[model samples]
Target: MVSPKTRRVLVIMPAWNEGATVGTTVTEVMNLNEGYDVLVVDDGSKDATAKVAAAAGATVLRLPFNMGVGGAMRTGFKYADRKGYDAVIQVDADGQHDPRDIATVLGGLETADIAIGARFADKGDYKVSGPRQWAMVFLAAVISRLARTKLTDVTSGFRAGNKRAIAQYLDHYPAEYLGDTIDSLVVAIKSGCRVTQIPVAMRPRQGGTPSHNPAKSAIYLLRSVFALLFAVTRSRSKIAVQEGTL
Candidate 1:
């Protein structure tokens, strides 16, 4: 394990039309004493998200068009892998994720390959609607069973990945919306990366509309279910092949 002083950390923020919040978010993360380098992947926003992030002293990677959150994260992972970063932490550009908790997430890397900052892990004021809460619990159960470990937040985007997980994602990152959450977890666990969650409080978005509305939430649930099933089936097939039973 590398010491904190020696480990090169990259904090990647995927921004899409978050000009109002991206600057503040970048500045906050860069203010940490952990010496984390900041990179903002501008996901082809029509607004001045890229300009604001760059002006905040973060290295901005501007995509030509909106590639969604997953695509932006994939680009970040590739950059981390190529630049030889020891670990990578992803923070939301909408100001929902607290920059102060970045250290807590990184601390999990001491024993796990991935550290997820979960809002529901402990009692907090973070509240979700009835349907969404139920959906999150159900998905968490499914993921926990698949990974053979108890997990509370399967959909959290506030996460950190070690070198192994970063390298795996460089090639296997899912390209769909919310792919950075559930789908990426499947990829990490299948690749033998250990995962754990740390309790963290979340704040409401500072600005910009949320990507998930009622219709999109339904679509997300359906797609997540199919993706989880596919991941499970694929894992089982690989196991059977390894056991010479395919």
Candidate 2:
């Protein structure tokens, strides 16, 4: 158990035009405990996302322009590292992930370097579309086969990681969609860091239209799939090298 004097958790929210929902998300996360520091990475939100987040008692990090989700998250990691947080939790600004699940991840951290909240852990609460379901399955299968581990939801954004994981990630993180998950998966596996997944309920967006670019969904899927495949392959090669088998 972490001592009260050294226990510090940072909740990082990568928000883009989520002024309507950012406040609620920040408040819920902050209400969990007093030691949790909330940081909202506003990616050039056209609305008042940063202001609302600050008003809700969250430390707001404003990106001058839209840098996409991954970029915003990387910025959050930087702040987490700079402030010397013991652990950092990645959360969505869409209000889909529950802040209450933070305890699950924190508890799991005792046995793992990183703990991610998986919506598919129970299978009953998952309500995504069929296409997305298939996509996630395909990705999971590929990850399991390559990473040599069973991971139900490797792409989940709701995750908690220690200071070492955060520092390593900020040093060599990717900057695109699904980049956070990919980085965490590959880095944790290659570095021999234990990663655990816990069941968490996710709800549909309570406010604001999704920022997903409909025109790029197909392209993004194809690109991200290939990117993950490449990362998996590269990570495997590194493992082989470390084992001196290559």
TM-score of each: 0.92, 0.87
- Candidate 1, residues 1-246, lDDT tens digits: the string is 778769999999999899999999998888876699999999999999999998999999999998888999999998998899999999999999999999988999998989999999874579777556777888899889777888998899999998877766775777765566887888678767789989999999988888778876656656777777766655422332343311
Tell me how far candidate 2 lies from the true structure as C-alpha RMSD in angstroms.
Answer: 3.7
Write the residue-wise lDDT of candidate 2 on 125-159 in tens digits: 76655445666777777766655667788888888
Clashing residue pairs, backbone N/CA/C < 3 A, model 2: none
**Which regions of candidate 1 are displaced past 4 Å?**
235-246
Superposed by TM-score, candidate 1 places the C-alpha of residue 125 at a distance from the truth, in angstroms, of: 1.5
Minimal lDDT window, size 10, model 2: 237-246
Q: Candidates' lDDT values, in order?
A: 0.84, 0.77
Query: Best by TM-score, which number?
Result: 1
Worst 10 residues of 1 by lDDT: 237-246
Total clashes, candidate 2? 0
